[model samples]
Target: MKAVGVVVEYNPFHNGHLYHLRESVKKSNADIVIAVMSGYFLQRGEPALVSKWERTKMALQGGVDLVVELPYAFATQKAETFANGAVSILDALHCSYLCFGSETGDIAPFLHTNEFLQKESEQYEEYIKHFMQTGVNYPTALSLAYQKISNRKDTLDLSQPNNILGFHYVKAISKLNSNMIPLTIKRYKAGYHDKDFASTSIASATSIRNSLFDQNADISSYVPNDTYTILEKYKEQYGVFHQWENYFSFLKYSLLTMKEEELKSIYEVEEGLENRVLKLIIDSHCFQDFMEQLKTKRYTWTRLQRLCMHILTRTSKQEMNLINQHETSPYIRLLGMSERGQEYLRSIKKNLKLPIISKVSGFHHPLFEIDLRAAATYFMIFPEPLRSRLLKTEYTTPPIRMSY
Candidate 1:
């Protein structure tokens, strides 16, 4: 069976995502489209606006043939590390292509840029160090280094979120030298950071989440009917939509109570950030305000948010280092699947490079433990009734299987 892979968060799967999934299948001409989706938390260093199970159901309903978990270690990291884990999984699955939505739409530039960076690694590193000495953020430093090394004006565009991630996907593929082809689908309607929900059929997930959680605006037109229904169910049961803001008090408590040494032990905590967090926790009123007080050129809001989340979950550097030592996912944990997806899994089950985890009881890895903690963390803010029912241990909750 030919399978095309996508690395996604789905975070509630809006209309734009539905469009991309259909286009990916059409463009790849594959039998199955496998999605490796983030669990609980997202790459931007924030909790998802909805549960992963709900999002997985949305993906299956929308168009994904199969879905697998992208472990928390990689899911919450920077773009490069996130892409590395995702590409590695797809390569292990022996997918034919990797398709992703991008602002540029064209794949030529990403390929060219990846090749250039690979060929000039030493020079690029030197430039990066030089720029870092100026106290700019790593992304800014990397962007400046790329423009310097490539000596192309357009190379600066690599800094855009989608473009940056797409470039990393290509780079990871090249690094692995896997057979999978890389492709891009042009993003439509709203831009990645565009917070306004337009009247168009598609809107960014950011806009939809903001509308649902912040303004309580109607987002029926921006998402599929099934998605709307699922969201409404969550709303009635859980009050407002689940978001990072909902966990602010927990995060603040974690921050205020954690020792400096303990804070330093968490992943992404560095450069005396532990000290800064301890100092600022007292003055901050909420998550948004805490983030504002801590934001700086050296630390992006996304980076700080991720750090705060790590502290809340007690995700330690030692744990992540152990994962790196292992070099790949311990198992492929199925999230949800359609009929064709089931067939695809069966076809590859015999020759799989990693263990297939259909039952959570079989998991003996620390990474899976982290995943469980993350899920539990997500439910802490949920209303009691919904929280009780929804907080089933991973062992008890089977993957969502959709029959025709």
Candidate 2:
């Protein structure tokens, strides 16, 4: 069975994601579309509004054939590292292609750019380094470097989140030179952060999420009928993200109470970001305000989010180095799979080199418990009735509950 792979967060599955999942398999002409998904904490350095299990079920029911966990280490990282982690998993899955949604649907130019960067264009590297040293943001640095290297007058907009991630995917696939083909589907939404959902049938997840909590907009129009029904069942149970401010305070306290050197240990704290964080978090009122205070032109909000995630995950410098050395997701942990996914897994599981671990705790590895402990952090922050249930939510969290 030929399988196409997608790297996703599906933070809460929505129509746009469903569109991409369907399009990926259709475009690849593959029997299954396997997704390497983010866990409890997303890349944005925030707790998933909904549980990962819920998201996985939504993906399986919506379109994806299989869902596997993308380690938090890779999931909450810079674009390059994120792509690397996702791509590495796909490579191990023996997938025939890697697919993603992009603002510029045209794959030719992206492929062209990917090939160009592969030669280690001296001018590009120099241009990028120069911009970085200026403390210009990463997105801006890339745009500047692209202009210098391509010498093309076309305005390369790296500002859009999808485009930036798409570029990283292209770079990663090119760098690895793996067997997987690269595929892109046009993103249905105009922008990643558009808070307004138009009635155009395809709405961004951000817009759907915003409308869900917004007092005015009708969110039922944005989600699938099934999702709409499910959400209604759980709506009252949900907490506004802002309600979790006290949790962030707990985290800040956890940090400040620790030794100065201990604060420096988390992943992405390489240049003393932790030290800056200590002074910064105190002056700022809320978590968002604290993050805003720490933001830099050189560091994208996404990068800072990862920094926050690194601290939350307790990822030490040693762990970061260990992960970097591996250069690929260590294991393919199956969260859930549909009939087609099972067939695909059976077909490719033999050819894949990495271990495919289904049960999280049964596995006697140190990493298994560590990931679960991190997942527990999710429960601790949201003190809902679900927290009791989450304590029992193990690696054995069954084949997802799906409602057609």
Candidate 3:
């Protein structure tokens, strides 16, 4: 009855993701797999190509036994906080192992790097800040500094996206002294940020979303038929991120109209990123553009995006800290579950510590509450039928697309 946990944002289930899930199950010899996924927004600081429930259903159909929501606050955060949030949830669930897709797929290197960094990390941190003062991007500064201190100049580019996120997972596990063993699956194909579906079977969510937006390029190959059917039903209904311009403007106005001191309450606002955000909100054409304008050497895009999302959700530093002190994940909310998943839940229901929620309004999690509302709000932006149906949609979310 051992469970393997995976933290994901299956914006749209794809072939590569399916491979990862299957490999994870086989590698871990897991009886059941639990995936803690982002609700509505993705890590890229944009609305998911599809809704959370849709993605949850896709996960279930795709092979994951159970799908749980990673609260919005964590899902849209920087790598460190994001990993912390996901790992904490998996640990809380008493999962025995974690298996994530990685470019290196070798845990030994990450483990070695983790030990070295842990034993001698203060110097690296100092070096990173020194580079930051020179106007290097935070991630680049971190990479450059780590290389200098570790004396692995040519080999220590751990800052590449997946590896960076992986490092955080390792760091968190070590810092927390958790027993969950970590494993990595070699990524099969398609780079994460790759914007086009180069192959018929393997593609990134970015590519699929791009297809959906372009109104051309057959997406029949990228997603499962079920997903296609779902997309067809709401193709015209879902408002793409581009359409969220008005919404972003609303957010900008909200920030600018607020008192200066009030802006300081938002997380990631230190050193006046808030003032920068407020000033540029009007100058930029869209959310992405706005972030570009606000990004600085001291703050990375991922970090700035997290800050922007926090602002949109009104997650204050005090509130975030208060919530963090009380609950990393207050309750494990099941988005969808297969029959096997249902059985697993039954077995762990009594032994588990946190409450499991299956509905939105029942949650008091500040971030969850906001994201759920935002999800509905975003759905409402879509035209008539979808807007109306998805507004109060519950389990109507269909099964995941796993039949690749």
- CA RMSD, predictions in order: 1.7, 2.6, 3.4
Error of 3 at 127 (Å): 1.9
Q: Rank candidates by TM-score, best first.
A: 1, 2, 3
| 80-197 per-residue lDDT for model 2 (tens digits) | 8888988988888888898888887867767777766767578778898899999897668978787766754333356567777887887777777788888989887546778776
| Cα TM-score of candidate 3 | 0.87
- Tens digit per residue, CA lDDT, model 1, 242-318: 66778988988887777888888999999888888899889887788888889998878888888888988999999
The whole-model lDDT of each prediction reads 0.85, 0.74, 0.74
Task: Give the C-alpha miss distance for residue 186 in model 2, angstroms.
Answer: 1.3
What is candidate 2's local distance difference test score?
A: 0.74
Model 2: colliding residue pairs: none
Clashing pairs in 1: none
The candidate scoring highest on lDDT is: 1
Candidate 2, which segments miss by more than 4 Å at Cα? 152-159, 237-246, 364-370, 384-388, 401-404
What TM-score should be assigned to candidate 2?
Answer: 0.91
